[model samples]
Structures are given as C-alpha cells and as structure tokens.
Target: MCLLLRLWPVLSLLLLAACDQNQVFEKNADFDSYTWTVQEKPAFEFEIQDTTQRYNISFNVRNASMYGYYNLYVKHQLFGPDGKPISALLHQMILMDPQTGEPRGKGTGDIYDHQFVALRNQQFRQPGTYKIVLEQYMRQDQLPGIMAVGVRVAKAENK
Candidate 1:
C-alpha cells in the first residue's frame, strides 16, 4: 500500500505531462472535416537577426493515420503589422513516419508511411519574417489530420 501511494503521485504527474505536452497545435478552431485541401492556411510570422542558425519547425498531427501524403512550405514574405508582407522565405518540411513499418506515401499506391516532414535552415536563405504552410494530398478523408508547426528564430550564417 505504501509503495502504491508513492507511485500514484509519480504516475499522475506523468499522465498530466503527456496530455499537456503531447501537442502544440490546437485543431478544434481549425476545421476537422475538410477534404484533400487546406481548409485554412495556418502559419506563424516572427522576426530575427540576419545571421546563420539552424531553424526547425515541429508539427503535431492529430490524425496521423488518416492521410496518405503530406507536404510543407513557407511564404515569400511574412505578414506585417501593416497587413503587408515583410520578406520571403523558402523553407520546406520533409515528413517522416512515426509508425513502425509504415513507409511514406503509403496507401497512395506505394509502400511508405502515411506522411512525415522535417526542415533545416541550410535549405533556406537569411533570417526574416516568414509563413509556414502545411499541405495535404491524400485519400480517405474520414478523419481530418491536425498539425501544429513551430519555427526557431535564429541568426543566419555569415557569408
């Protein structure tokens, strides 16, 4: 009984952390029944010094198994307070399978995982305001896949 009591608190904390940190994106406000298209283009815009650094965008997919393929992109210019774009960024995301033995482009007449994506700064130019876009191209729209993408603002490398 004593051991159980001690473990109870630990278990409770673990569960709470899992639920809280499991995702960064909220989907209820975003559509969940949309078909093979972006119901809404969700992106984050922020500014940073023009220097070299490695930036990473992490996306949380609610229905990871509901899609066959996924792709990510960035806007040419970021949204500004004046309701205009400030700069353009060419960043792309490459998705990877989280499921065991699940290959990419799977269920789309290929042998691969449902979808996966990742990106690095080397593939893009100097730091500036930008927009990240997530696109879906797949079959079976039973469950709408949810995604939350995060970008790290760092300096661009010196030439």
Candidate 2:
C-alpha cells in the first residue's frame, strides 16, 4: 500500500502527459555551466506528417531568479527538410515583470520555467522533418543564469 501510494504521483504525471494529444515534439538542451553563449546554438528537428494541420511553436526557457536582465533576446530560424530557410526572426521574451522585477511562468524557489509562443497557427508547406535553431542574442557574448532552452511543437486547436 505504501509503495502504491508513492507511485500514485508518478502515475498521475504519466497520465497527464499521455493526455496531451496535440503535442508533436518537445525537447530541451541543458547548459552544464548554467550559461548560454553566442556560439552555442540548440537545434530541434521534428517530423510533420500532416502538412494541412496548423501548429503552434513555442520556445522554452529555464533561468535562475538572479538572471541579470528582465528580458531575454533570442534569434530563431526555421528551416524545411530541404535545408531551406522558411522564416527567421529576432524575438524578445520577458522573463520578469518590468516594474516589479517578479519572475514569470512557473517557479520553484530560484529556478523558473517559461514558454513563449513563437509561431501560432502556422502550417507547414511540406510533409517532412522541420528544424528550428535557437541562439542567444543578448549583448554579452556569454549570458548567465540560463540553465536550459527548448522547443515545443503542437497541433493547433481549430477556432
């Protein structure tokens, strides 16, 4: 009974994850030194079998509460399976409240996790693997207090 009780939380989490039918791909890259450098670009590749389905793409960030800036700048590039660029943009994500300096998203003590939508209701041109590359675009060559970065692609709900 005690073992089953302990396993209840894990089972609940697994059930929750299994209920996410729209999630297509999700991946995260961790920085061992808790720093993101200009040269360290994380790339995520996901296969799309349905070109007609619209999807939403989000960028995930995990940072320490002591992160220097209130906002984090990042460059995102999307490429098709043919390795041709589909879209590129420089996006700014707010990590904290500008006035109050309070952290955003879910937090556990000093660490916080954030997911910002980068693309919404986007449809793919072809049915193949697509790639997204993320780069830290801060002024400094090395951005501190960033623990991990990730990407999530999900099927958009019809409106």
Candidate 3:
C-alpha cells in the first residue's frame, strides 16, 4: 500500500501532463495579406500552451510561384485566451516581399519538391499553452493552386 501511495503522485502528474500535451488547433483562412493566402479550405493550426520547449510546426502548399516552384510562408503566433498575440516566430534567414523591405517569406521549399521540414531548434520559454497561427505567408500571386501543411508537436529536452 505504501508503494501504491507513492506511485499515485507520479501517476497523477503524468496524466495531467499528458492532457496538457493534447493541443487544440483552429483552422483560420483569414488574414490581411494581399500576396499570401490560404486555400479555400481550412489551414492546419495547432493550439498549445507549451512554453517550456519547442514544437515542430509545419504545413504543405501547392502552385506556389509562376515557375511552378513551391514554398511555405508560415507565420506563428502565440495568443492569450483574449486573442491578444503573445509571441511570434521570427525568422533570421529573412525573406523579402517584392515591394517591401520587411522579410515576408515564411518557409522555402526545395526545387520541384514536396516534403517536410523539421524547423529544428524551436522552443518556447514558458510552459503555458498557446494558439499556433499558421498560414501561407506568400505564393504565386498571379495564379491559383494549393498548398498543404503538416506539424508535429514534441517536447523540448529541458522541458
């Protein structure tokens, strides 16, 4: 009975953590970007309050550029329940819009390729849950095609 009593605390903690790991993603196909747009369907979204570590976020796209080249322009934002943006996923590589100096590209794809990116070395500072906002930051603005996305949520090492 003593062993069972001691194990209960650990088991309960594990259960709680497992529940917290379950993310709720909302697909929003609405953004104010002129050059970038989501499909007529829904966008893949992951809502997690995980701040203690990094999570793998991803999605797919179609008919990106006029050259038939494809890429993913993804934007991530962590918001509170009140819908105020908390944190953002800012890229250092820097993608530029044709008319703007502000780096506007999200994720770039290999030549004529369809695959996944790990977004390695991604983590959050806190442990609270968050809503991960993802959308096509850019694509072939002249024509219409499609882009798909995939995201894998994992715990960071220290967390």
- The TM-score leader among the candidates is 2
Global lDDT scores for all candidate models: 0.38, 0.88, 0.40
lDDT of 3 by residue, 44-132 (tens): 33544655555554332222333222234456565555556756663322223445433233323311112233354456554445455
The model with the greater TM-score, 1 or 2, is 2
Model 1 lDDT at residue 106: 24
In the range 1-159, model 2's lDDT, one tens digit per residue, is 766653453355346557899999888899878999999999999999998899999998988887899999999999999999999999999999999999986755677778899999989999999999999999999888998899989999998
Worst 10 residues of 2 by lDDT: 5-14
Q: List residue ranges in candidate 2 displaced over 4 A.
A: 1-17
Cα displacement (angstroms), candidate 1, residue 60, comes to 2.1
Question: How many steric clashes between backbone atoms does each model show?
Answer: 19, 0, 19
Name the top lDDT candidate: 2
Q: Write down the worst ten-residue block by lDDT for model 3.
A: 106-115
Evaluated at residue 56, the lDDT of candidate 3 is 53
Model 3 misplaced stretches (Cα beyond 4 Å):
1-54, 60-67, 89-129, 139-147
Whole-structure CA lDDT of model 1? 0.38
Listed per candidate, the RMSD to the true structure in angstroms reads 10.1, 4.5, 14.9
- Best of the two (1, 2) by lDDT: 2
lDDT string, candidate 1, 1-159, tens digits: 756653453355346545753222222123445332444545655553333454433333322344444443433234444455444455443444445534343222221221222333432344454554444333333324432323333322334
